[model samples]
Target: MQSSCRKTIAELGPPKHPVVSARSAGRTRDRSPSPMRGYLIPSPLPTRRTRTFSATVRASEGPIYKGVCKCFCRSKGHGFISPADGGPDIFVHISDIEGEYVPVAGDEVTYKVCTIPPKNEKLQAVEVVITHLAPGTKHETWSGHVISS
Candidate 1:
């Protein structure tokens, strides 16, 4: 029985690329369906696409909350916010940040929270706006210029 199964597998060879219906794949009706409809060719380049945001993030219907910038790395494109209500620090993404200057530690900020996708166990700050800069500290703008606060 095992030999027969192995023989059948060997006869089939390696599996082919994933198949999808022409209509679902967005093929126009002008193209005639031949040889079991049009083939959905996979991209030649390796796929490393990452989803930076989701539909939930775009909703932005949550109440605003105040926080302090615990630490932010412009190069790394992420940081944490210390909630004013004394809650645990929440993750902050660079894309979600608003205003001109990049956030620094102790900078007072206002933001809304959004739960991360997949597991949805962790929270991240969205629509972050710096209300006040940390006194006597230097801040950098998105344009690569530095300014003292």
Candidate 2:
């Protein structure tokens, strides 16, 4: 019976339409005539080359400004800092952060400023150091262990 079933299944060929990956699928969701045809979708996350270039151009020797962590998404690899001087929140990349622990909301941090590329009108935080962890909140280390501070 098993041999007959195997012989019957062997007659069938491969699938007609092959699976198309998100990268290979150039059409938009609507599938309308798009000007971006054949162009690869840009990732929201920053690439390693971008991090290296920005780091080399912006040194860590500048005056450090005190700030509190507004919000940080470790998975997203970016965050915003509320400056102690009371201005717009500055963008901080994961590569810019120092220390073993990942930053959480309300954590006290000191960081240097760097102009965002292309326009240079916006500022971002670089060389970030977490001075104080937020009380009563759980903190996670880069090694994936959780600690209460």
Candidate 3:
């Protein structure tokens, strides 16, 4: 009876589970539950598109008036040149400048004029590339290759 059972089992071949094969190879068994019952489906998120512009750096006199850059918004015929920085002034927006990266404080940038006087204070940056980056004041040193022990 046992011999017949053994022959029947051999004829049936392997089981349809990865764990069974892994155990036959002297490996530890994994018993984690799977998410095949519609429990772990992932969903996509929404995204937004941003517009770009350009400008040029302009000089100013006030304490916060480090300088200004000119940028255009719609047409070239009309545009406004606003102060880039004013001491204690806090009305600068990221959309006002045009460039691959945002301009850091003390960075020299050029942009296009977007709004002119008697109309609006905002300027649409057509091109906003940094002309001069503030120099690094700190110094660093690195040691040469280490000797084998």
Candidate 4:
């Protein structure tokens, strides 16, 4: 483009003007934490809690499944077992238990499969025998058996 100002450089050289910038305003960046700037420094989240799980077996039934008795009421005489065989919890009735052994929650038992033989049926445990009682069970002693919770 042709210069609109036909005057020579010597005539236009010195003019009244000063450049303004952050540096001129004393706000230049220095790569250091700024005291004036507000930052959302998130505090470390509260220490996360950990979870634990019981040693459960794969669900199946044939050659004696090992499981934990989820719970049983002496009066109700029935409870569920989470089998180590990786199968869903199977129902265990008092009739299935052998000998004088009565189990409580957390008690370990070994048992074989027994089908109810009806529609909407699920596999159940029969011929159950208490292999071990978990420590701290309510059943401390029964029929001279020192059972653990």
Better of 1 and 3 by lDDT: 1
Residues 23-69 of candidate 1 have per-residue lDDT tens digits of: 65864346332321112111121111333445344537778999999
lDDT of 3 by residue, 57-112 (tens): 33111122233323221211222234455422222334444434334344455544
lDDT of all predictions: 0.70, 0.73, 0.32, 0.55
Writing each residue's lDDT as its tens digit, candidate 2 over 58-105 gives 555568799999888786577788999999778778887889999999
lDDT of 4 by residue, 4-60 (tens): 644533444446448766655755445443221221111121111110111012223
Instruction: Give stretches of model 1 more than 4 Å off.
Output: 1-54, 57-59
Error of 1 at 72 (Å): 0.3
Candidate number with the higher TM-score (2 or 3): 2
Judging by lDDT against the true structure, name the best candidate.
2
Each prediction's Cα RMSD? 17.5, 17.1, 24.2, 29.8
Reference-based TM-score of each model: 0.62, 0.65, 0.26, 0.50
> Which residue segments of model 2 deviate by more than 4 Å?
1-58
Candidate 3: Cα lDDT at 90: 22
